[model samples]
Target: MRFFALWNPFVFVGYDIASKQQIKETVRELYSSKPHLTATIGFSFAGLSAALSGAVWTGAVATLIVLACMMFRVWMEHHFRARSSEDVGEKWVRLFVFGSLLSGFGWGLSGALLLYGTSAETQAITMGIACAILQGAAGRAYMTPGTALINISLVIGQMSIGAFAEGNYIYVPAFLLYFTFLASFIQQMVDNRLRQLNAEQTAERLFREITEKNELLRIANERLATKAYEDPLTGLANRRKFDLALAESLAASNDTGSTISLMMIDVDHFKAFNDTYGHQSGDECLQLIARAIGSSLAGRDSLVARYGGEEFVVIVRGEAPDMAIAIAERICLAVRLTSLDSLPSAPPRQTISIGLVSSRAGTPETREAMLAAADAALYKAKKGGRNRVCVHRGPCPGQQQEQDTVVPFDAAKQA
Candidate 1:
């Protein structure tokens, strides 16, 4: 008897925890598919079980009390659902108090009945079942300091009844000791699991936030790299990218016995046009030339760039002076066709003068040397007259003289 009293609280606490876990899982599964039907069946089963158990062992009074408690629980569930907007903690607290009150009253009445007329075994069975069912359903409510007081009151009432009938007051202290240790163990386990679940949820949320931030940083880096290496106005490779490409093309030319050709293009009288029309119209003219030049070069080894101001550069691989000259002529013709009426000047249109230079593999000239030679030819074109293509013919009198007389184009005025 002493052993039974000592261990009963622990056993009851373990059963209560297991039962609550099962009920939570079951409710989740049922709610996912058939919430209304599942809840209705669950309440009906609980009410029926409590009623039958009470009637079989105790009496009509115990059965009535169990039925009334079940009905009150159903009503409280409805109230909670209706006030779904209320704070969940507050709602559960209210439900817990309500459940404890019902349990205390039911047990108190049973204890009295046992002390006056019923047997010890019957009283214990009825009280245990009633406590187990009520605790399983209302465990969330007892998440407060008040639960300890309620539980103490219950243990005292049960012990007093058992002691009064048997004349062995030792049962009172024995049951209290057993119940305290058992309830403490069960509460610790439940609390540990809840803490673990909370930690897992927090970790998942933090991981998702970190992933989103990394993706945003990746996109931002891509945009920065593109802006750094690309020309914003003409949507072409900028001068920096052009310089890198020229170096690579020169290296490849040396390795593969390929020739590299460079073309330097200057929009004819661009400054006069910009002054005549406005900065906006000048920008439109530059955009039109960029489009025409880009359209003229369609090979993988050819690249066009907004070299500087109104000047553009084209690099072509595996092409000789004649082929490079032909491509320059094609671009010149294409620009002539692109109507520049947006320019303040009317009709007979705007044109570009191009200078072409070709360097065969193993040539003594570097990429910068080739570009200087092309610029010299471009100067000769401007000197002779604008709007024509000039091919560099290696250190000729005209090419050297122009290289000496070359003047830098005014970037701001070139528009």
Candidate 2:
């Protein structure tokens, strides 16, 4: 009873590893045996059977059985290889198990046919050959322990039946003992392999988790970097980015002996506009004006930034004083024409005043001096009447007695 229980296919089904994993392992092991290798094994068994039994008929029958089994194995291997790993399941496993059974039956029948009417010495040699085949099957099929147990049982059963019918009861106990040891060895092998597979699966899962966390961290860093240098409200370069750009442009101007044009712009009566409408409308107005200014300067090599509340700044490199004035004029008209339909509670049109300063390469104008000059020009534009463009040509270090040359253009007069 214990001998039969040992060979039952369900004996190892309670292992921790999944049945699907076992199916994949079995298919992989089976396909690893190349067609030529299987052919060699089949021909060797047939050739040996004839040599030991001295019966060409038995060898011929063995050849037919081996060829039939080999062809089925080749077809099965092709079918498995063509399928995706995810698609492999119990149906395929059952098919493979059936094939293994067929193969074991064929080999066992070959052994029984070889043993029939043979001398006792020939019968002993035949049993030894059958044992060799059983050991080889166990090695090949141990990963799917159930399949291995089934094949071992079928092959050993036929071999034992042949020995008993030939009145060789003395060899029965030896076969039984050998079978016991082989079954124990197979069980140990299956346990070891399952442990290895479990370890590998755990390692793979950890690797994937680490990889996903790294990808998410990379994306968050990119967003943080962008926010560091960008204006959250307007999606424009903020003051920090503007400072860096101006410093780099100033260095480039020093090298190229070019002029650096700076424009400081302020929306006219913005405080009054905010007071008339709510803060929400003030935000909408600023967004609209920002879009107008950005559109006006499109395709120009320039950087525009919101300097502060109701104030914006622009830096244009390598342009003449007249070119700077033209750019300021464009900005004034663009802002004036800006549609306030999005802010229905606001006025029909809004206007801006721009203060321009052009610093030549050899000038000793520092960053602070240029900004002060632009601010003074903006003050001059307000004094000259709002909605005008003003340029400052004056000394860098402010002296109370030194009057700045203010060039102011009224948009209405120019029109």
Candidate 3:
């Protein structure tokens, strides 16, 4: 019974009967892609072989007939396209059976008519080729057992008839052995159909799971990358990001023969503000200062980053002497305007002391040198009193020069 079930081409062995409609749909979809192309090539090759074998007029007629049938099937599909899926499916099943019947008849006719009275060599060559073509049809038509079995009956059955009718002693045994091969071939096709369907389902499930996992991993990596380069407190670029941006800007400035500036900004008397107002209030002060500085450089190609406790760095491209001083003044003004009176004893207004340095295109200075120069200017601002902007130009020298300029705004004067 197992062998019989395995060898039976008549049984439509697919998914369970409960999923009959789904099976039909799957089979139809599979057939839709390759049938027309297969028909055209198969018929053309058969017709050409006949024509070369000196049956020009008959071959032409046969080729035209095959082409007309193929075109008719194409028309059949389009005609039933807008109907309900159930109706379309029924039509597809019927159309496929009819197509198989037509092609099978063509091959059976080739065997019945062409093999009559031919020599043993001609018969072998003719029927052998026909059997090979029928094997291919079996594979292509296996989605519907009725279609494949009908095609197999017509084409292979005709060849069997031809083999015995020739009455050559060797011909009958030759066909019997060939028939055994045919049984094995049909068994394989039936088994392969089930295997292929199962494999497709497994692949789809695995693919869906893999896609979900990949998306989650992509989100995790993005979060890790963001936290690495961002300051947690003020929501600005961290010092590491600041250093990278400064390096890139310096390289660009060198290529364009322009100046790129780095400004070191420190909250004036920040330690005193924290001591009097508490560390919580001091954090609020830093956040407000960062917002002000970011707002000051909003329209320019500038980067402002949190550079450690109560310190910030700003990188700007172009001439820095005038621009840096102006940006620093704007930052000081923006911070001073913010009202952060969380406690009674807090200072009336917060101010930042900024030291700015311009990296000239020809200057022999690195990013660290620019920071050091800006730091020197910041120290000068602290020495000359707080609430000020100072500019330091030229190379990164060890000593504070007399050419550095300071714009001091006294807390008493602002009040």
Candidate 4:
């Protein structure tokens, strides 16, 4: 068990670093291999030109041999690509080194062999050297640093030494300047590659951070939304959320032509209970009653909410009047039987009055109307003596009032 826990396959084991290294090496080989063919073709053109420009046919045959060597290297590269990915890195490096050495030596030999202290020989050698340097720098852009540097040196070094021996003072300085230019260009490419790599790393880090922050923000927003509608004391839907839900329910019922039901429950003599037992006990009692009410009305479609003080509300759909009344009776019985033995000395036997009202939609009935109907039923239960259930149809008992108290609407039915 301990070993399995430590090496859990469902969790965070990884080879992240090795995976990135493999990716980098594969890309490096790919880039380096592609440029080799282009470089080989450029050097071959220069080789053929130098040999054909000479008076002796020996330079021509030598250039043909060099071209053949370059062609063989290109064919080898094509075959290299057919190997498996794991084998590519080593084989690619070996091929790059061989190709560089072969092409470098070929150009260098042509420069030495073709030069004869004549004006035409000087011109031919100069053209070949210039072409070699330019093509090397441009076409070998993706080669390894060591290979590029060595190849450039070999191609120009022998020719430069041979040019000065012909007694042209300017040739030595010119060769030195050309080598200096090549060195500077190589250094620039290295610097650019380094800078690009740094920039890419920084961008990757920033993107990861931004993604993490966005995910955190999404989770935080979800928490805020849940809290916004929940009552802190009972962990039930608060009055504000209840109102919104009731309105939406009413609208949906109206559209679907279904009956929308609501039950408004008030603890019997709640004010007197709170006056005798302090507000804290009253709050605890309400929480217990709310929980009982919720459990009694358990289903996916019904919603139970704390409707301020000791008043609780329930909204349900897809129920006839019989089903709705049965649920309300269950809530009343549950509240009556709820255990209060754990708390301090208080009302051991408590009861609740539930006012039930349901509206067959498409009657232009508003949420306020449904609530007024439920409140009216609740009033009848309180007036006719508490601990009972009252159901209201669509009629207002507006004129019959007890002193300053308002009469509830829809006071036609009681259970």
Report lDDT per candidate: 0.62, 0.75, 0.68, 0.66
Q: Pick the candidate with the highest TM-score.
A: 4
By summed lDDT, which 10 consecutive residues of candidate 2 come out lowest? 1-10
Better candidate by TM-score, 1 or 3: 3
Residue 284, model 4: lDDT of: 89
- Candidate 3, superposed: residue stretches over 4 Å from native: 1-93, 106-130, 139-145, 156-183, 193-219, 341-347, 393-395, 399-415
Winner by TM-score between candidate 3 and candidate 2: 2
Candidate 1 regions off by >4 Å? 1-182, 318-321, 342-348, 394-415
Candidate 2 per-residue lDDT, tens place, 325-382, comes to 8989988998888888778574668888999998855764567878888999999898
Best by lDDT: 2
TM-score of each: 0.53, 0.69, 0.68, 0.76
Alpha-carbon shift of residue 33 in model 4 (angstroms): 5.2
What would the per-residue lDDT of candidate 1 be over residues 9-98, giving only the tens digit for each residue? Answer: 212222223335543443223112122233233333433443454534435554455455555656655665566453444345445455
RMSD (CA, Å), each prediction:
12.3, 6.0, 7.1, 9.0
Clashing pairs in 1: 6-178, 10-182
User: Per-residue alpha-carbon lDDT of model 4 for 341-385, expressed as tens digits?
Assistant: 766775676788878887754554677777777888888888877
Rank ordering of all candidates by TM-score, starting from the highest: 4, 2, 3, 1
